[model samples]
Target: MATLNLGILAHVDAGKTSLTERLLYAAGVIDELGSVDAGSTRTDTLELERRRGITIKSAVVSFPLRGTTVNLIDTPGHPDFIAEVERVLGVLDGAVLVISAVEGVQAQTRVLARTLHRLRIPTLIFVNKVDRAGARFHELLDEVGARVSPALVPMSRVDGLGTRDAAVTERVDLLRLADHDDAVLAALVEERTPPPVRAHDDVHPVFFGSAITGAGIDALIGGIVDLLPTGRAPGRGGTVFKVDRGPAGERIAYLRMFDGVLRVRDTVGEDRVTGIRVFTDGGTQPRAELTAGQIGTVRGLGHVRIGDTIGVRDAKAQQAQFAPPSLETAVLASRRAELHAALAELAEQDPLINLRQDDERREVYVSLYGEVQKEVIQATLAEQYGLDVSFRETTTLHIERPAGAGAAVEYNKVAPNPFLATVGLRVGPGDGVSFQLAVEPGSMPAAFFVAVEQTVRETLRQGLRGWPVPDCAVTMTHSGYSARQSHAHAVFDKSMSSTAGDFRNLTPLVLMAALRDAGTVVHEPIHAFTAEVPADTVPAVLPLLARLGAIPLATGAHGIDGEIPAAKVHELRRRLPGLTRGEGVLESVFDHYAPVRGKPPVRERTGPDPLDRKEYLLRVVNRRLTPSQSST
Candidate 1:
């Protein structure tokens, strides 16, 4: 049977989770429908999610329909938990972008649609809540076509819309899909049944339904089988979208295979798959193997990382289709050590949190998307890890980029370079962190070169101003190594031969000098926001937004669309409800980074500071400093 990994996604309160429940019930996987209000939804398994009546984690459920086993991933709708949605995107064979008919098109709705279009994932638009009052059908279609994609084809027309008796009548327009391709157009002209396949990006089919009353679900199911792509691809690797800890505290990796087979006991990359649990029509069944186009839980990959490839990799298997957290908050806790330890483990599951420590001040910091995410993290730490932590005010997470090209080199046995290895590097701006070689591969031992390159990257983590320098082009300009020299008698000797550790110890000093010469400028995160508010509140809101350094560009019936610094997003959110009498709905997404207007905020240097020459030499070369970072 063919398998399809479908995603059920929407903005918060758009009924995305309810739709997931309805699909499961319609497929007979569940005897009855589960309610989001009652906190009985199958996909919302987390207690936190039940209490908040929102999806916090992306939960996977499986059901069978029309000879296809569909693994429906119910992803979090909160933009705060969008990292969950981002992880789920790369694994989807097709998606159904849900919109609230009463709400029309929302800000997060627009974001999701744009991303789906960019990825060219085959998508179906579902205008939900047709049974609710204030539902608008034709207007929503016009809005979707104008604001979202104009290539929308309505598969069915709504009858009795905006009432409890709402129904969907089948009304396919074969001609509407003609513009998607010439072949389909020619087939239509010749009165031939055109090929059923449609371009994922070019043409989109729209469905109207209500998850509450189960109206129009049959048509949606048909769309799933008819419109979506089935996974039967060739190749031999999978993408790891999620990771969890087992009962024994071991890592459990949730992998979606793009192609080929993976069996228990098979070695994939550096780890072996010791156990497998495939999500099938009847729920997770422990199995000996996992095949192409299936998602499963694999155990015993002790070092498996999220987004890392398993087996021979293809481009789709390793694409970093994720974004980094743009805001960070300092966690203040009485049990600071425990909080740090817990955050470290949490970081393993969601690496974007990027736990960092201020060793000197004994403080812990965690990155976040917004205030809601900070709340979730606080709640999680309190309930799950038993640590009561309060976060400081959120701040923009800044990063530094190399200002200019600079080069530096240290020769082996030189006075300042005490290590018995020579390393050289040139730093400059690039698309992202990349390392190339000016020296031949045969110039030194591969391990030594590996050591130099690794240290160069590690050193760049905390640049001259202590902000991360993740984007730069680094080239290894020179290399030298001590030949293995030993006495006639085969005896252990450390003074004669250069170890990888020697290259590691000396690389920081050389790379830091290059960074000093190159210089850097700190860039702060900027976000674009769309706010839907009462028409009367726009006058009051524009000034408040302007005070927070927002540039309001367009004004619609809802409110204003503009760009604001990410640092001000929380403030905007806090003040908007009051200004609009609790009717204002604001959605914001990270746009880009611009140079800070004034002095950039500095994060206290952690581990060893390579910029300090005497301290770095004393700590690294002489081994006088306590082990800051174990590179050897």
Candidate 2:
């Protein structure tokens, strides 16, 4: 049977989980429908998700449609869990974007739609909640066209007058089909096969449905089978998008195979897969082999990470573009010793959590998406690890860049210079963080040159500000090696004196001197936000926006769109509802990093100041410096 990997995405509370339950039920995979409000949904398996009535992580379920096996990934709609959504996007063949009929297009809905369009994932729009009162089909359709895309073609329309009994019927309007692709237009002219709604940039087919009553579900399922593209035959590669622990504490790697069959005991990278399992309605079933376009979990790959490609050791895994966490809070624990180990376990699940420790202050810090995420982390630690923990006050995570170009040199011949390697480095601003090793042709052996370049890149991780250097470039301007040493009788020694470790040890001093000479400028993260409210609330919200250093992009009767510092978003979330009498909706995503217009707020230094030569050299020479001392 052909396989299709379909993803269900939406804004929060848009009946996304309901639609998934309905799809499984209609396919005979489930006997009864599970309710999201009752926390009985198959996709939401977490206790926290059950209590909060929200999806905190992405879940997978599978069912048969026609002769095809459909693997569905129900992604979290809440913006706080966007990282989860991002990881799934890289593996989907197509996506179903759910928009509530009553609410029409929302902030997160637009975000998801734009990302889908940018990623060029062929998408279908499901206008759900047609059973709710005050749901307007035509008006909502118009809103979708204006807000989402003008390329949407309605494949079905609402047949009932009221939402309570609304039904969907196939009624393709010929007049509305003109703006679609040539393949679709030609199919209409020939009156042969219906134009294929391909998974591409153009022509998103819209379907109206009430997932609660299972109305219009048949059409949606049929559309997925007919409209969505199937995966190519298995090749020799795939990507690992999720990592979890098995019931027996073994590592599990959830992978989406792009090509090639993966078998039990097959070696991927350095680790061998001990087992493979595919998802079923009831749970997982053991499978010895997974083919192309299939999503399955593999065990015994302990060193594998999310986004790692299996079966191909040299191929590069596509990096997921996720919004950086804007908030930072210190992690406090009752059992201080076990704190680091517990955090390492949590970081394995979501690398974005970014756990850091400060030896000077003896404190731990974690990066978070928002306050709610912070609460979830606390709850997770308590519930899963039995570790009681709380967070310190939240703060903005800032980054810095080089203020100017500079260079430095370390001479091995100098007295007490530490080793036999001589290195020189130059630093300057670049598009982003990058490194290159350049030298006069045959300045040194390739082995020594490679070692110097690798050491330089690793050392550049932290800059003068003690934060990971951003928008900077480093180059190896020069390198040197000592000639073969001779004994007192003029007999040559067999072993070479220079090593990669020597360059690594001397790298900090030279790189630090270069950075200190260049100086630094800090940049703060900014967020583009949209606030929806009643007309009367606009005036009250504008001042609050101004107070938060927001720059308005557009203002209308019902809402305002603007950009603000990400640091202020948590505050806006707290104040907007009160100002608009609990009727306002606010959503923000990381926009860009901009130079601080005034005196930048002081940040806690994560490492020794490179400009302070004495303190930095002493720490590096004494081996007191650690790799984790720098914040990224």
Using TM-score, give the best candidate's number. 1
Query: Compared with the true structure, what per-residue lDDT tens digits does model 2 show for residues 1-632?
Result: 88888999999899898999999888888889998889999889999999899999888988888988888999998888888888888788788999998877887898899888877788888989887887777777778887898777787888773568888887655435455456667777887676545546667888888899977888888789888887732335787778887777677889988877999998877888899998764467999998777889999898988777876522322644566777789999878778878788778888888777787887888888777888888899898888999888998877778889989887875543555788888999997667677777487777777676676665554566556665778888868867667789988763446666667667777887788788888788998888988988888989999998999898875489889998888789899999999998887777778887798665656555445555654666655433433211
Residue 316's lDDT within candidate 2 is 22
Residue 527 C-alpha lDDT in model 2: 86
Q: For each candidate, what TM-score against the reference? A: 0.92, 0.90
Error of 2 at 199 (Å): 3.8
Whole-structure CA lDDT of model 2: 0.79
Instruction: Tell how far residue 225 is off in model 1, in angstroms.
Output: 0.7
All models: lDDT?
Answer: 0.84, 0.79
TM-score, model 1 to reference: 0.92
